[model samples]
Target: MAKILMITGDFVEDYENMVPFQALLAMGHQVDAVCPGKGKNDSIATCIHDFEGHQTYTEKRGHNFTLNAEFDQVAASEYDALYLPGGRAPEYLRLDNKVLAIIKAFAASNKPIAAVCHGAQLLTAANVIEGKKISAYPACAPEVRQAGGEYVDLQMDEAITDGKFVTAPAWPAHPALLRQLVALL
Candidate 1:
């Protein structure tokens, strides 16, 4: 089993955040979910994103996800893998300098890293996806491209692994994403 650091924040996709955290734990991996400015036992809000035949997914309030680790205390070397869930949270989480450093540390260490949907935003901010074929919600393709990554478009339920990076379009690709991650781990 691997030790994983799950970096997420308020308003992270409900299913995306919960499913992987639980699934990895069930697989005997130790997953530490953390959010900047939060500590163990603190909770973050989550939201549901549904494709309702609109131009994009619609959002709704979701469960309160509890944090099991303190963000300020995490050391990239302490974990064997990293998981980043997508949602509105990445938009702001990408702005935290420490967050960017943590992401870079993971990338530099050649550890496995997984990101879905808007999680690409953080990867781009950290400048770690360059020369990689990365996937994310279609809207994030431009950011991925601008970051020197080749944007890969795939079905909603698909995932792609390039080097140590595994990415997907959204939560629907969890099975594929996790499968690829398990292989990497």
Candidate 2:
């Protein structure tokens, strides 16, 4: 079974973090979810981002997501793949040098990386998207472009796979993202 590392932080999208974690586990993969400044068993707050016919998605408080691993103890080489859950958390996690370094290590090893929604922000910040094609939330297209990446805008349920990288627009694309990730693994 593949050992997958999932990185998330406070305000991570509820479905993005939980669904994939459980889904991968069900597939016989071992998934370790971690967050910066958090230790094993520590929890992070989640937010539900729902599309309610408004101009933008609305946020609501969601369940507490517990971390099964410690971020500081993670070594990119120990994991076969990396998962980045999307939400407001990505906005800040992308700014962490340690987070960026972990991402770079994964990329350097040619390990698969799957990111959804704002999670693509980390790819941009790590400078690892250059010349790659990715699909992310529409709002993040500009960042992808600025990073020298071609952003393929997709609907909520769609995903794009380019080499070792797979990305989707949001939580709605979990099914597609997970499928592609499984194939890569």
Candidate 3:
């Protein structure tokens, strides 16, 4: 079994955060879900994002996700892999230099990093996806390209693995995404 560190924050997509967290745990892997400024027993708000034939995805209130680890207490080297879930959180999490550094550390070590949808936003901010083919929410295409990484426009249920990074369009690809990540682990 592998020990994986998951960096996430408030308003993350419901399915993206919950499913992988539980599925990975169900697979007997150690998953530490953490958010900046949060500690063990602390919880963050999650939101559901889904498409309903409008302009983009619609959002709604979701569950209160609990943190199993303290962000400040964990180091990237302590884990074998890193997981980043998508949602509005990445939009702000990208502003945290500490978060970016953690991502960079994982890339430098060449550890398997699995990210879904907007999760690629953090990857772009870290400047570690350059020369890599990364898949993310379609809205993230520009950032991916600007960061020097080839943006892969995968189907909602499809995933792409380029080296140590495994990414997908959204939660619809969780099955493939987790499988790819686990294989890399």
Against the hidden reference, what TM-scores do the models get?
Answer: 0.99, 0.98, 0.99
Ordered list by lDDT, greatest first: 1, 3, 2
lDDT of 3: 0.96
> lDDT by residue for model 2 over 71-172, one digit each (tens)?
999999999999999989999999899999999999999999999999999999999999999999999999999999999988889999999999999988
**lDDT for predicted candidate 1 compared with the true structure:** 0.97
> Model 1, clash count?
0
Residue 163, model 2: lDDT of 92
Model 3 per-residue lDDT tens digits across residues 79-161: 99999999999999999989999999999999999999999999999999999999999999999999999999999999999
- Judged by lDDT against the true structure, how good is candidate 2? 0.95
Q: Pairs clashing in candidate 1?
A: none
Please report the TM-score between candidate 3 and the true structure.
Answer: 0.99
User: In model 3, where is the ten-residue run with the lowest total lDDT?
Assistant: 35-44
